[model samples]
Target: MPPPGTFTILLFGPAQDRAGSGQVTVQARVECTCGELLRALGEQHPALAFALPAARLAVNHALVAPDHRPRPDDEIALIALVDGG
Candidate 1:
C-alpha cells in the first residue's frame, strides 16, 4: 500500500515497457493532479518523457481529463499512444 495522499499508477503498453515495471507510486500531499503525476513520472523515468505527452491517462478505471486530480487510493493507468492506422 502507498502512503497517505499517494496514488498508484499502473502502466500499460509502451508506458509499462518504458517504465520497466507494471506500476509506480507517486506522493501528492499538496496537490497531485494527473498532469503533475505524468511530469513526475517523466522526471523519475527519462524514457517516459517522450511517451508521457502522448500517453492517455485513466484514473480509477475511468478516463479522465488531464487536469483531473486523483486522490489517495485512486488507480492511475498510463496508456501509451500507438502509431498506425
Candidate 2:
C-alpha cells in the first residue's frame, strides 16, 4: 500500500493531453493544492504549461476552489474548459 497521506491524480481530456495518459502518484510531502499540482503537471508536460493558466482543476469529481487541498487517496482530475458555444 502507498504511504500515509499519499494520493493519485488522473488527468483527462485536454489535461491528459497536457500531462499525458496513465497515473501520476504524488507523495504527502508535496502540498496537495489543486493549482500547485496543476503547475507541477504543467512543468512535467510543457504542452500543458502552454495553456495551463486557463485550465480548470477538480478533486474527487467536484469542482473546487483554487486552493482546494486534496486528501489521501483523493483522485484529482484536471479538465481543460472548452470555450465553444
Candidate 3:
C-alpha cells in the first residue's frame, strides 16, 4: 500500500503521451474524489489538462465516475478516450 495521503496513478495511451510517463503517484487528502484528482493532475501537469476531463478514472481496474472517492491501496488509473476512423 502507498503512504498515507497518496495514491498510485496509472496513465494509459494518450494520457501516457501527455504525462510523458505511464505511472505516477498523487498526494491528496484521504477524502479525495476522482474529480479532484483529475483537476489536480491538470493543474500540476499542463500537458495533461486537455485530456483529463475526458479521461476515465478507474480504481482497482474498475472504471469509476468522477464523483467516485478513492480508497487507500486502490489502483488508480486514467484511461484516455480514443477516436479513430
Candidate 4:
C-alpha cells in the first residue's frame, strides 16, 4: 500500500486533452499498478472512459507493463495514440 499522502501522474498529447492538463495528481488509496490507477482515473473522469483503451501509461518515463506496480511518487504519464504519416 502507498505509505501516505502521495500519488502521481502525468498526461500527454490527446490524453492531456481529456484530462484538460499535462499533469495530474491523485491521492493513492492502496499501493497498486499503473492499470489500477488508470481504472480509477477513468472512474473519476467518465470522459476518460473512451480514451482509456487507446491510452498508454508510463511510470517514471518508462512504459509500464500491464502489472507494473506504481510507487507513490512515480511519475505516470498517460499518452494517447496518434496516427499519421
Candidate 5:
C-alpha cells in the first residue's frame, strides 16, 4: 500500500494501456479533490496527460464530481472512455 498523503488509482481500459499498468500512485494531500488527483496523475504519468480531460474518477464505486474529496478508504478508479459499437 502507498504511504500516507498519496493515492493509489486503479486504471481501466485505455488508461491502463497508457500507463502500462493497472494502477498508479499519485502524491497529494488526503484532502485533495478529484480534480487535483487527476492533475497529479497527469504530472506523474505524462503518457496519460491527454486523456485526463475525458476520463472520470470513481470513488467508492460511484462516479464523483471533480470537487469531491476522497477518503483513504475510498475505492478510487480512473475510467477512460471506451469506444465500441
Candidate 6:
C-alpha cells in the first residue's frame, strides 16, 4: 500500500510514453487540488514537463477542473492529447 497522502496516477498515451510507465505515485497533501497534482507530476518527471500543459486530469473516471480536490483513494489519470488520423 502507498503511504498516506500518496496518489497513484495512471498514465495514458503520450503521458505513459513520457513517464516510461503505466503509472506513477505522487506525494501531496490530503486536500490538494488537481492543479497542484499536475505540477507535482511535472516536477517529478521532467520528461513530462513539456506535455503537461496540454494534459487533462481525470479523478475517479471523471474529468475535473484544476481547482478540483482529489482524495487519496480517488483514481487519478492523466490524459494527454493524442495526434493521429
lDDT score, residue 28, model 6?
87
Number of backbone-clashing residue pairs for each candidate, in the order shown? 0, 0, 0, 0, 0, 0
Higher-ranked by TM-score: 2 or 4: 4
Per-residue accuracy of model 3 over 46-70 as CA lDDT, tens digit each: 8877787668788898989888999
TM-score of each: 0.78, 0.66, 0.82, 0.76, 0.89, 0.90
**Which TM-score value belongs to model 2?**
0.66
Off by over 4 Å in 5: none
For model 5, which pairs clash?
none
Give Cα distance to truth, residue 20, candidate 5, Å.
1.1
Q: Candidate 2, after superposition: displacement of residue 37 in Å?
A: 1.3
Model 2 clash pairs are none
Among all windows of 10 consecutive residues in model 5, the one with the lowest summed lDDT is 1-10
- Sorted by TM-score (best first), the order is 6, 5, 3, 1, 4, 2
Clashing pairs in 3: none
Task: Give the TM-score comparing model 6 with the true structure, all chains together.
Answer: 0.90
Clashes of 4: 0
Please list the residue runs of candidate 3 whose C-alpha ends up more than 4 Å from where it truly belongs after superposition: 83-85
Q: How close is candidate 1 to the true structure, as a TM-score?
A: 0.78
What is the Å distance of residue 6 in model 2 from its true position? 5.6
Per-candidate local distance difference test = 0.75, 0.66, 0.80, 0.72, 0.87, 0.87
lDDT per residue (tens digit) for residues 44-72 in model 4 = 76766777897768778788786787777
